[model samples]
Target: MDKEFKLASQLLTLLDTEQRWFTLAEIEKNLGLSDKTIRKMVEEINKQLPSTMTIEVSRGKGIFLQRDGRSRTVSEVISSMFRETIFYRLMNLLFTNVGRFSVEELAGAMFMSTSSLKKLIVQLNNNDLKPYKLRITYSTPMVKGDELNIRYFYWKLYGDAYEFTGWPFTKINFDFINQLITNIENEKKIVYFINSKRRLSFLVAIVLERVTKGKSVKITEGGYPWEKGAFHLPVKALAKVLEESFSIELLKSEIYFMQSLFSLSQYHYYEGSEMTPMKEVELHKDKEEYQMGNRLLTLLAKVYPNIDVKERFTLEIYEFFDKLLIDNAIPEWMTISKSNLTTYVQKECQQIYQEVQTCMQKWHTAYPSVLYNDFHLTKLTLLVRSSLRYKSKKAFLVIGEEFSIRHYIANLIKKEIGDQLIINTSIMKGLTDEMVQQHHIDFVISNFPVALKTVPVVIISTIPSKRDLDNIRKELLL
Candidate 1:
């Protein structure tokens, strides 16, 4: 990330946390910047943001983020800033460039001084590109690295940064790519998830852009199993379409690489009307992802036995593991910013978060190559919590009104918390400890204050209001 992008992201993030206006002094204090710099950053960010969203300034009241249409997230705002950075523009240029270029030519294309462009390349080489062993050689200004690593680096960079919001490849037609993906789906008898289809389009566009520029992947090993499977047919068909569309032939290695990308977990599945790729997962039990899923489930059982690892949950875990493996293999450099999710999980359910962290640590110990981070922990914790089938809480409704009113109150409570609570109605006159004990009531909901010593009592209006439901939720921990 660029320094300006980081500063702009910080400003947007601070504003996103609250809806109220912040005085200039408050903004300066929070961002640790001078008032002048803060104003400049805000102005630049506003220029990048769409018409629907903007940071509005007031004469005396400071600044506020205004949203007249669909709200944009802080990350989205940051990505918009990211696209304008010299670093992003340079990388995007390199990914689509056909051959090596003179330093002057490249700098002129970015409208930057040659010396400044060289310094930027040095910064990228020392920081972002260091991990992937990719570096832009100053002599010719071309990215040099392992072919697969190069492709993975750009795919992750563009995917994380753009994310269907904009088309980075101006030369490639988006509609043509979508049509090609639709053709693949129709021929392969599979349906790509909507988001997955977009991601696939991005990957295909990257591959086409790179390969057409004479940058083709080199297959080191004998090729993946999917190359000879049913999936290869669509890849071959896709290759033919590309050859005809671009007037270029794809190398065999390029075709194999495309096939591997398409076969990645959760991209598409057999069109059996099933939502997940459970059938595909079962067919590859011997795969590392499958074994990792089983290991994770066992670890979850030992750590958090209360969670039910049912079939649906099991498939979800498998899919998650598969994605983890792919991420590990590629070693993406771009940050998939989900800090909001991490914070939410840590605050909402610390116990489950810690449990997931423990399981992830154990799994990492078993397979050191598969590293886990806060992002992975947050995702897995959410999955486990979502799959949990909570035991119902028993509640007794005590109404002192007429029978019809009592039933009406009961129905209202039911409508509010029927999914989590089993409500039993009783008249306040006859409600006693014996009845409460017989029903095993976990809590009591009454129209008036009740003196129940065994169970907690929640007082509500004749017709339960939002506050009443909130009180019930607090008492029952719903």
Candidate 2:
């Protein structure tokens, strides 16, 4: 994604998440964007969005996103924008072409001058393609890199840009791919999640396209030992179906690549339940990836004693490191933009981010070859945050007004921040410092000034406004 589209997508996502009108200052603070840029982005976004959706800006109230019942989601809107970019267009063109083309030919196809096309390739090679050790060759005007990296790059580009929004492979039969996946599921006695199925379909389509073009993967390093596990039969089944349907034969390395993807945690699992058996966990216990996951959990447990080291979380971490250790060319940057995600983690969850960074550093020291980056840190932070037992802060609401007024204020607070706080109500006459200490109140919310040194007090209107609630949130750090 380009800078403008990324910014527009960020703005749209922010608006979608809140689904409420925001002041100009609030938008500026959250997005770290100036007013002028924001206005331009909104204009461009509005032009691209369907008629049923728009970013509505008001002179006094600022801006908010408005969507009708038929409007597409934020992901779909971003995907549509991605399709308009030259990067997506170029990648799609190359995949479909699957062969060498002259710079003039490519430039003409994209309706651009050869000079401009060469400059774009230079930029991509220096930045986006640098991490993958991949680049668009100037002479052939095709993606030139390790076979694994080439396949992985296309998989990620297509997966991130299109996802479930639309199929990018126009020539490939979607039903045929679905049937292939179904046959594998039947043979393996397991079913893929809807998302996993879609992801597998993309991988299959990419493999078919590449294989048909004689672009085969060759495992030069210690190859993936697919036969050691339970995936060989499924791999054979997939190969047979591809050969039967597309009249193309997949090499051993191509089959192993498919096996590696299928075994990833993101792709599939046992049919009946989401849980992985403890016996299976023990089976991989001796593996370095499993041990690494164990060490990470142990280190994190010091900070978060209540962190749930359940089977699912443990399995995911194991599988993550497993992918990292494998020779397959999964990018260290992962799918999302590195800077954007890292910035989010740094701002929103600083402590978790710092701890995960420390853990990553330690892992890098242990295994110097596996390049861990912000993507790994962000993912581990999310996993740790999910496992934590978050305790809600207790709030005592003291109102000097009548029953209805107190009830109304309490209900308003509840509606805004009920999940993060334990709300307790009391009339002013019944409130005391002893009571506040006895209940261990984190903060006090009152209409009148409360003379309590034990806990911080927030003064609000008898009927609280949005500003009043916001103030309460600031005091409580909610």
Candidate 1 residue lDDT tens string, 233-352: 888888899899899888877776776667662445565646445665575577667788898899888755557776678877876776565445444422332346898788776766
Clashes of each: 0, 0
Q: What is the C-alpha lDDT profile of model 2 across 291-342, one tens digit per residue?
A: 7777777777766666677877777777767766553343422443254567
Top-TM-score structure, candidate number: 2
lDDT of 1 at 145: 87
Evaluated against the true structure, the overall lDDT of model 2 is 0.76
Candidate 1: where is the Cα deviation over 4 Å? 13-18, 23-30, 47-53, 70-81, 98-100, 160-162, 188-190, 219-224, 228-233, 243-253, 265-292, 324-349, 360-378, 394-478
> Each candidate's root-mean-square deviation in Å?
7.1, 5.8
